[model samples]
Target: MTIREQLDALSAERILLLDGAMGTMIQKFNLSEADFRGNEFLHHTKPLSGCNDILCITKPAVIASIHQAYLRAGSDIIETNSFNANAISLADYDLQDRAYEINVAAARVARESADRYSTGAKPRFVAGILGPTSKTASISPDVNDPGARSVTWDELEAAYYDSARGLLDGGADILMIETIFDTLNAKAAISAIQKLLDERCSADPEGAAAGRYDVPLMISGTIVDAAGRTLSGQTVEAFCVSVMHGKPWSIGLNCSLGAERLYPHVAALSEIAPVLVSAHPNAGLPNRFGQYDESAQTMAGHIETFLKDGLVNIVGGCCGSTPAHIAEIARIAANYKPRKIPEELASGAAAKTVLSGLEPLVVDPAVGFIDVGERTNVAGSRKFLRLIKEERYDEALSIAREMVEAGASIIDVCMDDALLDAPRAMQKFLNLALADPEIARVPVMVDSSRWEAIE
Candidate 1:
């Protein structure tokens, strides 16, 4: 079913409940490395330890049972056990080639369990998990060169594409990109998902599954701390704007913080984001021993405030949460109506005339006169135009940095040169420019005389 159909079916309730921590439940099995391998890697040398995603293929019963538990506990959504099933994360166990196999099996397992418990009253939906990998794309591994990153855009894109292909093949209803710490990394995943959608629609004009529904997309990020910013140094609002291109089904904060600590940040998203807001925080702050001691009742009590105030449409747990915690959340968070997407936000008016680097350049009449860096233009900087013609995106980023340092609040990115593929040039330069904190910390004004580039 499409996201709208699911929502219409469950229209009686607000705050569609999502399942709690997959890692926490996976630990309950107490499986060994051999169990993780399950004959597939029986002869392999490298340890298969900490490879929870592989359990979908090896320990199908255990994984399905976990999904069953969440469904019984009143969860409307259950995520696939493929958090680390991508090529990047699988390299740790030397099972990179099995990334697609791992994800397909994981999604299939979760789908079966969700279908078993699905009902006309409260149908279950499977969300394919796209995790934030071990590497950071926006931060430099080498402090000496701030622009250096551990992962390239293409690598991240490829991993997400492989995982997404497998997830869809196994019948997932939605794609959830969770625990996002870097907005650029999240962008790569989102881009890959869009690519999948384009390919599917192109191959089958009616869409996969004969036009039943499009796989709804959802993105959840991490606040990181009291700073109220992502690990990439973007405020909650800026993070929302950075990934706005994805046009997610829902956007909110989750993980790294407990229910209480996550409240304010979630509230911020509810106020600003142009989509449904969802939050899944940890049970509570870990104690000195690194154990989550927050009881299920206490966690539910805290999450209740969000429901009472209508700040979230989806709520659940992250670290150290279980079915019992989800049960309490489901019991208390019912009857409340889903937070309505404001007519203005759903119309996407907030997306226009805004270049968000560190903060948004909100181009409304209320703001002061904005300074747009016009030097990236052919008329202003012959060197910039020349570099664009040659496709030197790296050098192009340097020019953008200079423009930001020159006191411009918004970078007027013009890729309208006839010699260039305007759309490709615009996408390349924006990807590079937005990855730079110096440029990303402000808004970007996409300028083009050609409608193709503007679109």
Candidate 2:
């Protein structure tokens, strides 16, 4: 059977076990800057001491050994050590040009390790880890300038495309976009991977028909704080609504919070997400000295609650977890059945027009009429148009806030004035509007006569 088929069949029977932390295990090696360089760049310009992704090239055996340990401890799925191998993140170490090489190496090492552990009855899968890069597309780095973006959507798409292609070439069974702090960044990855998959299908029709390129995608987001919102300020439902267009095989939460703190968010996802829900929280929160204090048994105790409640189809560890943690999780997981996917969701019967900004607004007849504030429309509101012309964006965003405060479920924004660059003005205003939580809690209706401005 193909990996997707096997995954579906096996997950329907019982909860799948994912591996524990790679960085935690790598820390045990106590390697130096020289070790990270591996004679490849002994006299390089920048310091390469703590770049863990580089280990796939510098110390393949070490990475493989870690994978083997997780597999031995009973991980049905092992993620490649390519978390920060994307061009954007690798630029810190001046290794941005080698992103493809690093990703390929990472997946190849994990692939070899998983293959060794495979059997007729029990097969292992490799999940190509696509970490949220150091930069974000939705949020502004400069607090003074809400419209300022550190990274563009195009840059993110190109970086993810290169990393994803390398992983596919190196034999990854699934692509896991994990620890997502920004929904827009995740969207970029989904778009890039979709493009790559379509290209592969076009290049090899026979292979596509045989399910050779039918790799599954698993998306997991991170809840930044106790409020249960991503760093981009999206609620669980809004985040799901934003990325559900990707048609992921599974969606869940990982990183940021520990198991106990992350439970409510995962529970919320399982309730509404049409796909399988997975959770791999950290081994409890960090201590004052910055370390995970939860033991294997303690962490497993929390995960047992998830299993008992039928909240997850896949469960495992994240930061600060070890092989022992995976063993305990695997042991407990064997006792519980996986969460069942909703029939309506699986059959496409639960489809609805759901709009979101930071919060979701389900447009249904049951919920009265939706009030769309049109004061932000430049063509309609002279004041809004004047504000844009004067470059007074901060004051302009206040108008959007006023609309939301006046009970507008959705804000209608338009920049169709001939004197203004409609597309540029629309983009700038929307970015600024989304930066404010009060305005972002409700959706925005992009009203534009120009298709270029709307797109």
Candidate 3:
């Protein structure tokens, strides 16, 4: 059977076991700065210490060993050690130019290791790790300037395209975009993957028609705090709705919180998400020294609760988890069946028009009318237009908040003033709006006659 068929068959039989933390396992090796550099960058100007992704090229054997260890621990799926292998993140070590090469090496290492453990009855799979890059597109870096952005969507798309291409070339069975703190960044990754699919379809129409180039995408987001929201200020439902357009193979929460704290969010996802749900929470919340304190047995016990509740189709560990933790999880997982996808969702009978900003707004006749506040529109409100011209975004955002407070389910924003750079103004105002949860909790409608502004 093909990898996709194997995955379907296996997941249908029982909960699939994803490997535990790659970073945690790498920490055990305790290699020095020189080891990270190796002969690959002996004379490079920038220090390369602590950049785990670099090991894919500099220490392939080490990466392979980690993958092998996870496989031995009964991980049906092992993620590549390419979490930070994108151009945006690799720029920190001056290896941005080698992003594609590093990703290829990472996936190749994991692929080799997984291949070593594959059997007809029990096959192994590699999930190419697409980490949320160091920079965020939706959030501003400068606290003083809420409208400012460190990275553009085009740059993110380009970087993710390179990384995805390399992973695909290196034989990854699935493209796993993991640890997402920003939904916009995840959108860029999805866009890149779609572009790849388009290119493949164009190159081999017959193969594409035969479903030969189809790849399963697994998306996992992180809840940044106890509030059950991402760093970009999206609730679990909003996050799910935002990315549902990508049609992922699975969606779930990972990193940040431990299993106990993350349980409610995962349960929430399992209840609503039409796709498969996966979770790989941290062993436990970190101690004062930033160390995971939960033992393997303790963590497994928490995961057993998820299994008993039938909340996950895939289960694993994240930060601070090891091969032992995965072994425990795999052993426990063997006793439970995977969560069944909803029949209505599977039949496409539950499809609806859902829009999101920081929250989701499902447009249904049963839900009553949606009130869209247009006071934020520059063309509609002179005061809002004046605020844009004067660069008083705070006051403008207050108007948006007031609209939501006055019973608006969606906020309509338009920057169409003759005196303003409409696209720039729209981008600035929307970025600032997204930074404010009070305003972003409702969906946003970017109203513009100019396609550039809408884009």
State each model's CA lDDT, in order. 0.85, 0.93, 0.91
- Sorted by TM-score (best first), the order is 2, 3, 1
Question: Which regions in candidate 2 have their CA more than 4 angstroms from the true location?
Answer: none
Per-residue lDDT of model 3, residues 1-455, tens digit only: 55577788888899999999988888888989999999988899999989999899898899899899889999999999999999999999889999999888888999999999998777999999999999999888999887789999999999999999999898898999999999999999999999998999999999887776788999999999888999999999999999988889899999988998898899988888998999999999999998898999999999898899999999999999999999999988998989998888777798888888787888998988989998998878999999999999889899999999999999899998789999998888888888888888899888999999999
User: How well is each residue in 332-365 modelled by candidate 2, as lDDT tens digits?
Assistant: 8899999987888778797778988899999988
Lowest summed lDDT across 10 adjacent residues in model 1 is found at 4-13
Which residue pairs clash within candidate 2? none
Better of 1 and 2 by TM-score: 2
Model 3 deviation from the true structure expressed as Cα RMSD, one decimal place: 1.4
- In TM-score terms, candidate 1 sits at 0.86
Candidate 3 local lDDT, residue 151: 99
Candidate 1: residue 116 Cα off by (Å): 1.0
Instruction: Sort the predicted structures by lDDT, highest score first.
Output: 2, 3, 1
So what's the TM-score on candidate 2? 0.98
Q: Which segments of candidate 1 are over 4 A away from where they belong?
A: 1-3, 8-12, 208-210, 348-352, 366-368, 375-407, 412-439, 444-455
Give lDDT for model 2.
0.93
